[model samples]
Structure formats: structure tokens, C-alpha cells
Target: MKSEELTGNLHYQIFGLRSLYNLPDSVVKKFELHYASLPDSTIAKDTLLSVIINRKLKNSPYIFLRKKDGEVVTIYMENSQYQQFTKFKYKELIDNKQEVCIKLKAEKLMGRYYKCISVTSVKIKKGQTLGKQGKFLLYEYE
Candidate 1:
């Protein structure tokens, strides 16, 4: 399938709540020294300030694996007793279009450390049409 990266300035909030999900070892190590003096509760909410975007090919029976920059699609078949696969579709909304733009930003909070402060994704005025299919089926967007 043909694909291209469009420009967007969308904003997203990425909160790292330890109660819900633990931060990865690499991330923890990266920020460990910076937040060492902070309380455990505060440390638990490590800031992951970045935006990730991805696209999928039509009729693809694959799983979407998110990465720091983009996404990867993988196809696998396992025994029903061990694993399962599900299909889904995407419904475009009036406020949500296919056009996209992106910008990344980071900042230091409380003069203590630098963290991802903002990620923007805006619509592209001259955006080209993506591969068209019967329906917009994707593994995930966020």
C-alpha cells in the first residue's frame, strides 16, 4: 500500500500512572536521577511527552505494535486456546479528517527537569488522499 507522512499539530496528554501501568526500565533509568528526590507518588506519574502516529494497509490481518516514532504491523496465527484475533473498523467523524501535521516540544518544569511539554498535530491544507478502501479499519489510533 502507498503511504505518506502528512503534517499535523494535534495535542495529546500522556500521563504515566504507575497504578495503571508501570514505566519501562529504560524510561525509568532515564528519569531516575532527575526525579530521585521527588516523592514516590510524584515519581509514579512520570511524564511521557510525545506523540505517535501510524497507518495500516487494507485487508491486513496484522497487529499494530506502537513505537516511539511510529507503528509496526505484525501477522500471526496461534491456537484458539492460546490466542485470538479480532477485526475492527474506523468511523470518520465530522471534526476528524484524514489530513495531518505534527510538531514536537519539550520543557523544564519547576526548574527541576526537562520533560515533554507538548505535541501538536494539525491538518494539512494540501494533504493527499490515503489509500481508499470500503471502510477504514485500523488496529488502533491512540
Candidate 2:
């Protein structure tokens, strides 16, 4: 699909969440968690926050939660229109227990030029993309 199509799909997902959960756009767009806890707990919280933020930046279709047991949990936001597109890819990776390669493309306006970019065949690590260029890291399931 085209980049615009992908972006539209993501926006649809975001708006769907707002409608389904009755959440304000601000809440859906970003989240923060504060804890009053121990050192290890703080570390875990920080790790989880980083993961979520990275995923958001990458335009990944799923939200991840890292449990105290160190297991990463995938939560497909039900309202996301792109959930089906992402779920299938994730399932394939999980079923095979193998890494899936991905490509990322982005465009930026630099002065008078529109610079189009591409990064290809990046690896997935810890359920997130490695070496992909973007704010959010993409992931293949499993």
C-alpha cells in the first residue's frame, strides 16, 4: 500500500480508539504512568514506557506491555482499523518462531526538497525492529 494509505489506516485506528473507549484524543495520543515503588519496579516501569513510546513512534499497530515476569505481552487495540493487517503478520512470526524482515520509508521536507527515504530488511529484536529508521520501532510477533 502507499504511504498515505498506511498513514490513513493508522489515523483510523487512533480515532477508533477514541470513539470506542470514549477516550479523549489527548489520552489516546499519549500516556504517562507514575509509580511510587522500589528500584527494580522503577526500572521495569521505565523499560515498559520506553517500549510503548518507541512502538508509537514506529506506527506499529499494537501496544505492548512488559510484565514483571519479563514476558512481553501484545495488546491489539480493538478499535484499530489496521489491526487485521498487523495481526496476520504477527501471527506468522509467532507460529514460525522466526524473525520477519520489514522495510520503513519516510519523507521529510528539507528546505526546498522533499527527501524520500527507505530502510529495508531490518531485523526484529525483543519484539521491536532493530536498525529501522523512525521514532517508533516495528515488531514481528513471536
What are the per-residue Cα lDDT tens digits for candidate 2 across 1-142? 2321011111111111212134455665564323223344445534534443433432333333232343332333323433333443533444565443333343322221111133323444334311223444344321
State every prediction's TM-score relative to the real structure. Answer: 0.22, 0.21
Estimate the overall C-alpha local distance difference test score of candidate 2: 0.32
Clashing pairs in 2: 57-136, 58-136
Winning model by TM-score? 1
Q: Runs in model 1 with CA error above 4 Å?
A: 1-98, 106-116, 129-136
Best by lDDT: 2
lDDT tens digits, residues 39-111, model 1? Answer: 6565333332110101111111222222224432222112231122121112332134433343323332222
Measure candidate 2: CA RMSD.
14.6
List the candidate 2 regions with Cα displacement exceeding 4 Å.
1-85, 88-95, 107-142
lDDT of each: 0.28, 0.32
